[model samples]
Target: MRAGGNIEITDLMRFGHLAAAVFAGWILIAPSIDCARRGLQRETPLSEWEHMDTFTTQQGCESYRATVIEAEKADSKNLYNARYAYSLCVRDDDPRIKGE
Candidate 1:
């Protein structure tokens, strides 16, 4: 967290592998969802997804997700074409981001 309790992008990259911290707030799961090849990735556990930075508010989480998707679009390798490969903004307590 910086001077404003805001997380830097680099921090997210550094800790991307640790998806579910289950903080007291909310979190964004920016997993690599290739439904075309994996079929919704339902067999994969949420903890395996690439976790984005945590947010205190739903609006903030969605805003960051949009920002990330926009940036990903610039990269030709992004998974925007997938049927369900978008970041999810859910409360840390959400069971979906936990053990299956």
Candidate 2:
């Protein structure tokens, strides 16, 4: 009714249109952002997996022994670290690891 004053319905419609536009823009952009963040942009070379399988099987018995030894070491180390971290968490005031 006054100068520079729009009607209530017009204002509400404008606000809704603006909100819809923003939402549409976000919907379009979100998947692209996720894909880039998740490294989907990188194209894997076709031969890489083939080469890895060939190399793994070619080493035969030695590779199997080495893999088992490494796995055992990793398991022991993880167990030790987990226990130490849990004990430290109990002593601290942080509620992250504390549970009922």
Best-matching candidate per TM-score: 1
- Give all candidates' CA lDDT scores: 0.66, 0.32
For candidate 2, write residues 15-74 as lDDT tens digits: 998976454310000001123354221123221111111121224534543454465565
Which runs in model 1 stand beyond 4 Å of their true positions?
1-23, 32-43, 79-85
Judged by lDDT against the true structure, how good is candidate 2?
0.32
Model 1 C-alpha lDDT per residue in residues 1-100, reported as the tens digit of each score: 5666898888887686455443357788756566577534545667766666888888998887777666666665545523224567878877777764
Runs with alpha carbons beyond 4 Å of true place in candidate 2:
1-7, 25-100
Q: Pairs clashing in candidate 2? A: none
lDDT of 2 at 60: 51
